[model samples]
Target chain A: MRYETLREQIIALELGRRERQFIPIGLSAIDDALQGGLDLGAMHEVTGPAAVFFTQMILRQKRGGAFWLATSSPNEEYYPPGMAQYGGQPEEVISVCLPDTKDLLKVAYEVLAANVVGCVLLEVQKPLTQTQMRKLQIAVQNTDSLGLVTRGAHTGTTSPERESACGSAITRWYVTVVDWSHEKTQIELYLVKNRRGSPCRWIVEIDHATYDLHLVSVSGE
Target chain B: MQRMICIWFPFLESERLIRQNHDLATRPFALVMREANRAFVSALSRNAGNMGFAPGMSLADVRAAAPDMLYFDADPMRDIRCLQGLLRWASRFTPRVSRGGGHNLYLDIAGASHLFGGEDVLLEKIETQLEDFGFTTRLALADSKAAAWGFTHFGSTKSNITTERLEGAARELPVEALRLSYASTALCQRLGLKKIGELTKLSRVALTSRLGLDGVCRIDRFFGRTAEVTEFARHKKRLIEEEQFFDPLATNAGVEAALERMLEKLCQRLSGMRQGVRKSQLQLDRVDHETMFFSIQLTRPSIDVNLLKRLFLHHFDQIDVGFGIDRLILVAEQVAPLSCHQLSLENSQTQNREQDLEKLINELSNMVGARYVQRFFPVDSHIPERTFSRVAALYASRLEEWQSPSGTRPLRILKKPVSVLLRDGIEKMAPETVFWHGRKCHLTPLSGPERIEPDWWRDDPDWRSGGRDYWWAKADFGALLWLYRVSDEEKTQWFVHGLGS
Candidate 1:
């Protein structure tokens, strides 16, 4: 009886570990660097210009719908038609616009805890505190859902310390516009913090027509 | 075989005023209406009536007789609303409650009276309830609605006349109880007929010749010879659960406990009926005789007790206990049939996930607003701003297929276009550099100017600039911007409409 009980506990642990799967970023180099891809059931933060676009690309990899929570600002409105250009289903996206920062955080927690949607993108103007971040992380940890947070690049945080201040996020990234030509725009993505892998950087080219990102160069090479 | 009950509020307007402001309960108050520049009393309080003040008495005469009496302009609309509320409340006794001409209500309580033991018990209960609600009422029951109305207004304060005695009882009342026109009543008095029994002696042809067919019909209706059609109040079956406390609850915990108990009972009832509540109301009756009400609307029908408790607790702190609550009532104002789904073990997880999503939508909608939580659908329009529209997530049935436009679109669009200044002069095609957001940026056009015109059938203010020539360009900062130029009889102007990533 004691042996049987021990075996059952071991099986349950294995099942729990298996539930935390990773969502591939569609780039083979990035996928290999992160040991498959970004972890589901974990919180990730992305900042700098084109953060929303990158987040939309990552969300398109998931199967189910996503909840987008943002403040009710005219400048922050996402164009559904434009989002569709990146392979996002406009009808499957549930958008919530809240004027209050507190309400935005509360709704973000609720959507994460619901664990029904595949992804949740929260755009917050104010920086979240360590406690708020941990609370949200704890909420999403119970389910196979991904929490994506995007903040303004000018939020008064330096690169190194900003990564350390992320209390519960599994990974932190900063993407900035580098240069552009007639057909493609070049962007630099820095993997500032990765819990399970080494930090890295990449220079990528975005095709305007297809909205696809091409891996141009790695940091070491 | 039909039994009807009529409830008459002799001082409806004054009683309604006193119910709202209890200070005027003992005071002599009157409601006045202006007629030909003269203020005539339309309704009087009990004290004012005892002081020999009657309706139609001019305000000047009443003021002279009782100088301290209070009078205000009558609100007929408010009185009608009060009567309508009472009509709904009276449906507890019988389903068929109809509104009388003014200040009176008729209830068809034929077989429903037995539920309250008998007609006498039902009438007593109605009178006591109305009295508790601060209204002075006179009630009468008879074999017909006309007889009931006649007996309530002209007979005793509380009378139950059976079929054998309905004619005898109505005959003793004045001819005015027949509900005839003023001209017909005057003609009856001119013929020396003061009572209904005196008019019954006249032949039908004689009465019709002297008072017209309308007068004869009124008498026939009063005597139960003619059937009178009445428009009953539309009553919908409601699921209500309430608890009355001997000791008023003063703490938030106590109220929450009571609410939890009521929610459990209500959920059980809904489940048994295969229904769920879409909208619900919570009413708290305080010890001070004041009632507090809170309402909650859901995105979909739900019968989950815990979910309902969480939603109701959102408004629990807003309740001011005042002197404590003596009674709690929960009413499901709207309900819909919800069939049970047979879920397999494998599908149960998926079903629960869907339910969780629905709960999340409802919670977020309640927190922010239903309108703020929405999904986008493509509209059949070419205008950049009119390409899509938002519908509340609760109301959206399914994901609509988004028809992608032929050309590339921006990831984000500005709510209002910001004007951009051109560097150097505008070239024949497109500007080589532009000042956007206070920064000079070089632009390389990757696509031509796709001309889009406004819909001619409708006048849209956003498209008031006439037609637009759109261009997709790569800016110096590596950002792809969507630019539009509008040219009319005036000079050409450029604006940055969207940002592409």
Candidate 2:
């Protein structure tokens, strides 16, 4: 019933004549999970350890632009390798390493106000407060740029304010590193909340050696 | 004879304004502070002496004279700036006004005296205007800077002197009216030259020898005997252009479009004057008289409309547009004369290349950012990092295109490489096992113990853990990582600095 409504809207708007929106991280399962990639001009929370997936997603080659805010590792030397892992040119990558939460807010708002960067990733350990998140959401929406915040496991801890920061995030995804013993390390991704669509769980295998992710086929039919 | 006018404010008034408060203009206020046994009044408010207050009077004596007077400490430098601002405002009348030695103005109204009717009318107009603005000005007119400076000091109290009677009246005035220093005044007194007419009797060389060069020059200038260098106060150009919006712009696009219109008008004004602007100040006025101002500076003199638009495009989102934007203004400043480039037929090739380079820079800047789009240039330095300085948003060609002197450098230079721990004191000696980030790892193979010295000039002695020696070490499982050891006062410590992957 939902698909019929969406199809009717697309047909009514004559969207078939237009080209497909080619977002780089267009995995079928992830797209369906995200309800058609991250919405333009919105905030998404992708929480994990030293989030390399978020890095790749932001560094994706696009005609527009990409921005990365890495705070987990303060050193600028670590950015090139992560960007190179996704076949993105290191020289072309723009990353801002904000030292603290205050600086993060200042730099993020500036990036949004510029309206240059198509994708923005802010990696922070402690989750932002509701006020901070509210301010950032307004900046992103006003600029028409997609903003992603990466947080650690305790992002949704007992502190309701901390939970509210993630709650204000348009979508939230849990990225947990699963050890496959002899097999390559796999990242088990769980869609915690989908504001636009239904939530689902999926396993994506990551080649630790090559730093690549493969979406696994669920045993259905 | 031609005429000039002088306006004198007693001491430095503007500098002591904050302390003087409302009393600065109305009451007989004096900014008095004692340095030694002598009490000196640094600044005096309007009609201070008229209200029976004099500078250099003892604090006790001043209290006896005007007991209800207010006092303040004076700053000479700030008063000079405020005076300059007023002089700039006055420049609209004439360009020949010169700042006097001590809180006085000297205007060479010689050729341009007829603009404001006669010299008396002009002086009256100036005095009345200044009086309306809460300033007490003592006005005088004469044929020369020295002659005018002389009359205003002495003649203003004696008789009603106008520009018509200045030359004859100047001759009878005391030589002390010339504003000569103590030595010059003493020399004039010793020579029995009590009047301007008596000093005019001496030869140029004789007068110079007796009164010194400055005194001779002033005397010569006032008498029209020699040339006088009258320094005029510079006029700052006020280039203000504004756009009145019918309906306040609420969207970024609307504001940006409005700004573009303003920028075009401002650039046209600049270019029409054969000038290229280095900086432009933009003001966005919203409802209720709130103003948002942002200024942009070009790396070089630029009149290109597209470049200016691109730079301002980033700041459009910052406008509030609260209750809607009512007006926008762009002011051209730091403008310079731009020489037009004559193009040859072959110049088209070069122009096309420049256009391509500009496009590349704009695209890269848009992709990364204006702050991040940088170009590195080689410098005359032995150190690797010091060899280049990042130039933000440069449209020049890549630096590596030109051949450079070869130097040894690391494939991966860390942005602040981590401090490490060494097992033993030896640098070349391989670590059998190393613990890093709470994990123990065995080394399979090792290479390099390159020493890197700390920049002693920049390194803080308190925070200095000492110099580091980096090494490329591989684990048994084929995990290649970079490690470094900090040689400190106690011992060396090794740390897993970075991973090759």
Give me the candidate number with maximum TM-score.
1
Q: What TM-score should be assigned to candidate 2? A: 0.49
Per-model TM-score on C-alpha atoms: 0.70, 0.49
Q: Write one digit per residue (lDDT tens) for candidate 2, span B1-501.
A: 445677776544742473346545555667766687777776566567677566667777777777787766666777787677667656656787778778787666666657889666667777778666656567676656666667777775323355467567877889888778898898789878899888877797887788889887777677655656777876666677788878777777887887777777777888888887667788888878899987766545667888877776656666676788788888876777775656669678656544444454453354334565454444554333454445564434443322232322322234655544444345545555665434555664445566666667775552277665656655433234566666556666665555432
Candidate 1 chain B lDDT trough over 10 residues, lowest sum: B472-481
Instruction: Give the Å error, residue B273, model 1.
Output: 2.2
CAPRI classification of candidate 2? incorrect
Q: Chain A TM-score of each model, in the order shown? A: 0.82, 0.69
What DockQ results do all the predictions give, each relative to the true complex? Answer: 0.44, 0.08
> Which residue pairs come into collision in candidate 1?
none
Worst 10 residues of 1 chain A by lDDT: A152-161
